[model samples]
Target: MRILVLGATGYLGGHVAERLRALPEATLLYGGRSPGADLPVDLATARPGPLAEALAALAPDAVVNCAGAVGGDAVALAEVNARGPAVLCAALRQAAPGARLVHLGSAAEYGPGRPGTRVGEDAPTRPAAPYGATKLAGTVAVTASGLDAVVLRVGNPVGPGAPVAGLPGSVARALRDAGPGPDAVLRVGDLSPYRDFVDVRDLARAAALAATRPGPLPAVLNISAGRAVEVRELVRGLVRASGFAGRVEETAGGSTRSAAVGWQCSDVSAARAALGWAPLHTLADSVAALWASVAGAPVPAR
Candidate 1:
């Protein structure tokens, strides 16, 4: 099987590509604007006509799109998160309609979920910001595209190789910089929001399953831990894993999504039923691994 993975150099995409490459009879191809990529494709600016020509040549059996902008201006987000998927779908329809297109969407697309309720895929998408709105646009493009496709709406991804742009990596960096100084105070924004955190490795495994599974699949599936945890817990876990003795003070200014969405969790039952997928790592495990990656040292076993 020939598989083309877009954004294969990104945090999530890299892991997905690694997992897919392990398949016994699979030929994994990287598709991106990166010079080293096998297929030089940039979804953000790619047009269907030219992209169709490229796709025709590659003739991939499956295309997993992990390209997206997590934090950017409206125009940038729309370009990558919204226009990118639409263009990819258009090109696929013209050249590789039979190829399965697995898109990585964001849990932010669901907006703020009810405090204790697990939001299902069927829940209405009411994005609180451009990031979620743009991601929802991408999700719509894939689900509405007349192709063998599935959208994996992922939650807060935490694990190794996590970039400092996200909360997990940001906290880890702060702790590492602070060292073991007891007087060091790590000031952060409000961390009272609840989030569904999933290990990046587990998410990659789900992507592999979705790409290789036979027959038709649901248009969308929630990929999450199925449990809403306080954001402070994740922060504290990193601190413990990093052995940081500093104080983490909750100050003003942080992620807008956290402030807007007080609670967010997903119903992952559909994923288990459809793809036999369930997260294997606990939040603690993810935290430990993240700290290990950032600190370059083994964490205390829990």
Candidate 2:
């Protein structure tokens, strides 16, 4: 199938691009804001006419929007997270008719999930942060535009220097750029919140599958492992994976902002049942690949 992946340089989007590149007879189209893309698509600034014309040239069967503003002011976030997808929806419908719009959503859209309850796709989207709020707004706009859309609420996607959401990027950064102290220290903030971490490869796999989903698909799907992992445990695992007997301390401050969802465990049954997708990589496997990348060593599978 011919597919277009927006935000192709970002972490999740990058993985999706690489995965699609590996598949046979799949025409992959890449677009992004930066200069290093097959086609430039500035979601926050591009007009509908130009965007529609560009998309129409591709004739894509699926348009997976992975564009987002991970950290920014509410206005900036709204532009990329909300208006961006909305614009893309209109453009795709006019240009690439009959294309399925697969938008990547965050579990944070549900705010703080219940500790004991598994969050399903039908769960209320009471966003607690600007990021989630804007994303949910964008999802609503796109889906309500009478377009065939699939909003995949993905969990914490972790890999070597993945992105802003998971601990892998933070841990890898600290390990690489920390002070030259006596101990290999990895300073972090509160380690109380629990999250469901999925390997980026697995999430990428799900996205690729969703691109080729047959017939009419569901409105939303949760792509996750459905397991709660403590934040501290994630740090500890990274330390062990790095083979660094360092002093990993819980510091006072880190990122200035936090996600709406402090605890996230997804109910992935719907995705499995509908999309025929399952995670093949484990948490330890992700941690190993992350450390391997940070250490500049040959990455071995777990």
Candidate 3:
């Protein structure tokens, strides 16, 4: 199987690429703007005609799109998250319509979830911010592209190689900087909101399954832990994993999207039925792995 992975160098893409590499008889192709990528392609600004030509030449059996922007202005976000998928779909339709296209989407596309309910794939998408809105646009493009495609709507991913742009990475960074001092204080934004946190490795496995599975699949599937836990708990879990004795103070401000969506969870039953996939890592497990990877320290045996 010739599987081309875009954004293979990114956090999620990196993990997904690694998992796909282990597939039997799989020829993994890296597609990105980075040097040394097997296929030099930039989805954000890529035009359809040339991209179609490139796709035709590569002739991948599957294309897994993990390229997306999490933090950027409206134009920047839309260009990558919205326009990128649209263009990629157009090119795929022209060149590799038979190849399976697995696109990564965000749970934020579901907007504010009712406090205790699990938002299913069929839930209405009313994104509360530009990030979610753009991601939703990308999902729409992929679903309507008339190609063999599936959009995995991922939740808050926490595990190794977590980027500093998100909470997990930021907290890990802060803990490292603070050291083990009891007097050190770590201040952060509000941590009371609920989130569905999935281990990055688990998410990668889902992507791999979606890419290789035979026959038609649902247009969208929620890839998440299937349960909501307060963000505060995740912070505390990381703190424990880091052996940070300092205090954590929740400040007044944080992600505007978080503020708008006070609670979030996803119903992953469809994923289980379709791909036989489930998140295997607990929050503690994810936090420990994250601390080990980010802090450059082995987690103390408990």
Candidate 4:
């Protein structure tokens, strides 16, 4: 199978491309703003003209759109997160109708689910932030495009990558900065909200499975670990794993503030039943692996 991965250099996209390359029978091509193994097509400024030309030349069997803008003003989020995928779906429908497209959506789309409620694929999407709203819009656009597509409403993908500067990256930074110093004070936001975190390798594999399945087109599936952990607990786990004795301080910043305090998780039974897929790593294991990678230690087995 020939696959085209958009946002090839991104956190999750990079993993997806790497996983595809591991498959001996699969031929992978990367499409992005920069030159890669394949052609360049910027989803941010994608119009039918350039998009059609680029995709037409590659002629992939599957197209995985992992491209997105996470944090920005409302307009910027809409352009890159929402409108970009919509335009790409349209272009793909015209250029390669037979290609199966897997869109990487976010668990943020479901916003904060009620406490103890597992957000399923059919859960109501009440996005609390501009990024979530735009991502939800992208999912809707892809579904309405009348193409062979599947939407994976993914959770927080944590793995070895650049140190994220926001709340999610705080624990990582704390682990990285662990040393004999005043318990390395690390500033954080609300730690009450619970989140379902998944390893990027597992997510990339699920996406590959989604792309290979024969479908009616435009199916929405929630890809998650089906387990919720509070931010405080996650921090404790990371601290224990990395021996990071850190003092976490709360900050009052809009961008770093938690959007909701409810249980934000998903029931990935559909993914398992349909695709026969399950996450190989737990949150604790993922955190340990991330810390080990950051600290240049051997990665533990999944």
Q: TM-scores for all candidates?
A: 0.97, 0.93, 0.98, 0.93
Q: Alpha carbon lDDT of residue 192, candidate 3?
A: 88
lDDT per model, in order? 0.92, 0.81, 0.93, 0.80
Best by lDDT: 3
Tens digit of lDDT per residue, candidate 2, span 189-281?
Answer: 877778888888898889888888777778888888889888778788877665666677787554433433568789999989988898888
Model 4: per-residue Cα lDDT at residue 98: 87
Candidate 2 residue pairs that clash: none
Clash number for each model: 0, 0, 0, 0
lDDT of 1: 0.92
Residue 161 of model 3: what lDDT? 79
Candidate 2 deviant stretches above 4 angstroms: 36-38, 164-166, 178-182, 252-260
Model 3 C-alpha lDDT versus the unseen true structure = 0.93
- Per-residue CA lDDT of model 1 for 1-302, tens digit only, reads 99999999999999999899889988999999899887798899999999999899999999999999888789999999999999999999999999999999999999988999999999999999999999999999999998999999999999987998898888889888986988998888888889999999999999999999999999999999999999999999988877788788998677965469989999999999999999998998898888888988764343
Model 2 worst lDDT window (10 residues): 252-261
Off by over 4 Å in 1: 298-302
Q: lDDT tens string, model 4, 138-240?
A: 9999888888888998987787663474444556766577674665876666677788888888998998888777766337888888888886787777767
Model 2 scores a TM of: 0.93
